[model samples]
Each structure stands twice: as structure tokens, then as C-alpha cells.
Target: MLKFFPEEIEFKVPQVMKTTKWIKSISESNGYKLGELNYILCSDDYLLEVNKQYLDHDYYTDIITFDNSEEEDKLEGDVFVSVDRVRDNAESLNVPFETEFRRVLIHGLLHLMGYEDSTDELKLQMRAKEDECLMLF
Candidate 1:
């Protein structure tokens, strides 16, 4: 199941239904099933606390994925997204907010699919996958 909640934002997603279907399809196409995927939208401060508590990092990021998948082919996790970061990143990247928003969502999904972005090589591959996935929209 896919669910979305606002942890620190007071709002509703415009195209939630469509986005959910797209995420589900992305999982299925990668030979996996989506299970209990939750998206929490929050502010930078809220996410910063989460990062410091869970990841022990003092930096801000667009999205943080807490993986809960037990097997290789099943994707399950909590993806926390910072709206503040998304807005800033979109502006910095010179792209529309909706476009960068979708990119961040898929970026989290790609991580759940066993794609890493730690090393330069892996980051490039991950970016390629993200770009490929974005074209599906």
C-alpha cells in the first residue's frame, strides 16, 4: 500500500492519485512489489531533527528513506521529504517545483530499488536511472 501524510505541512497534494499509480508501476516494472510505502512531507526544520536523530548528520537533504524491505524484490520504506528543500532545490536547479518534486520522489524509489549514489560512478548510474524513470511521467 502507498500512503502520503503531511508531518509539518498543512496541505493536500494536487495529483496524489496519479503519482501513487506511477510509483506503484515503477516498483512493479522493476520486478518488485510496493509494500507499505509511506511518504511524509515536512518542513526543513522537522527533517533536520529527523536527520540528526536518525542519521546523525547535521546537513539538510531533500529526502531521507528509511528502508524496511526484508527481501530483495519487495520495496517498503518511509520516505520523508522536506518541502523547503524541494522548493529551494527546484529554484537552484532552474526547474519547476513539480518537476523537481517528482524527481525527488523517484530518487527515493530508486534507492529502494538497490540503486546507490555514494560513489561517483554509482551517483552517475543512479542519476541516469532517475532520468529514465522521470521520462515515464
Candidate 2:
């Protein structure tokens, strides 16, 4: 199941058509069955606060994933996305809003699948996997 929890603020996200498809594809490709996936769209301020509080980082980030997967076959997580950052990143990356938005969503799912981006090489691999997953959309 997939659930959306929009914050008090509203930001247009077109429709989550491709986003849903891409998420399912990524989860399946990683050999896990998705259970409950929660999406929270919030302002940059809210996400930044989460980053600082939970991650001990003071910088703004596009997305953060809180993995709650209990078993190898089950996939579960809370994907917190910053609509503000996504919009700006889309413009900077020269991609459509939906495309960049989906990228960030897949990035979070990748984390739940045990992918990391803490190092330069890992970030490159993660980006490659993200591109591969995006192409499947």
C-alpha cells in the first residue's frame, strides 16, 4: 500500500502516475515485495529540520528515507520529500518536475534496498541505478 501525507502547505505535483510506476518497478527489481510505503511531501524547512535532527546535518536535502523493513522479503519505509528542493533541482538539472521528482523518490527506495551514497563511488553507482530505474518508467 502507498499513502501520501501532504503537509499543511500545498505544492502542485501534477499527478503521481509515473512516480508510482517507477517506485513499484524499483522495489520489484530489488527482489522485495513492497508492504506499506509512506510519502510525505513537505516544505524545505520541514525536511531540513528532519535532516538536522535525525541525520545531524544542517544542509538541505532533496529526500530522506526512514527504512522500516523487518525482513528480507518485505520493503517498508517513510519517504520524506521536499517539494521546494525538488522544484529547484528540476530547474537546475534541466528535467521536468515529474522526472526529477521521480528520481528523488527512486533514490529513497534505493536506500531501502540497501544502496548507499555516503562515498563518491557509491554515489556514482546510486546515480547510475537511479538512471536505470528512471529509464524503466
Poorest 10 consecutive residues of model 1 by lDDT? 8-17
lDDT of 2 by residue, 32-93 (tens): 89889998999999999999999999999889899998988888989999999999999998
What TM-score number comes out for model 1?
0.96
Residue-level lDDT of model 1, residues 17-106, one tens digit each, is 888898999999999999889989999999999999999999999999999999888899999999899999999999999888989999
Candidate 2 local lDDT, residue 22: 62
With a 3 Å backbone cut-off (N, CA, C), the pairs that clash in candidate 2 are none
How do the predictions measure up, each by TM-score? 0.96, 0.92
The candidate scoring highest on TM-score is 1
Candidate 1: regions farther than 4 A off:
none
Candidate 2: RMSD to truth: 1.4
Position 14, candidate 1: lDDT? 54
lDDT for model 2, on a 0 to 1 scale?
0.87
Scored against the true structure, residue 125 in model 2 reaches a CA lDDT of: 100
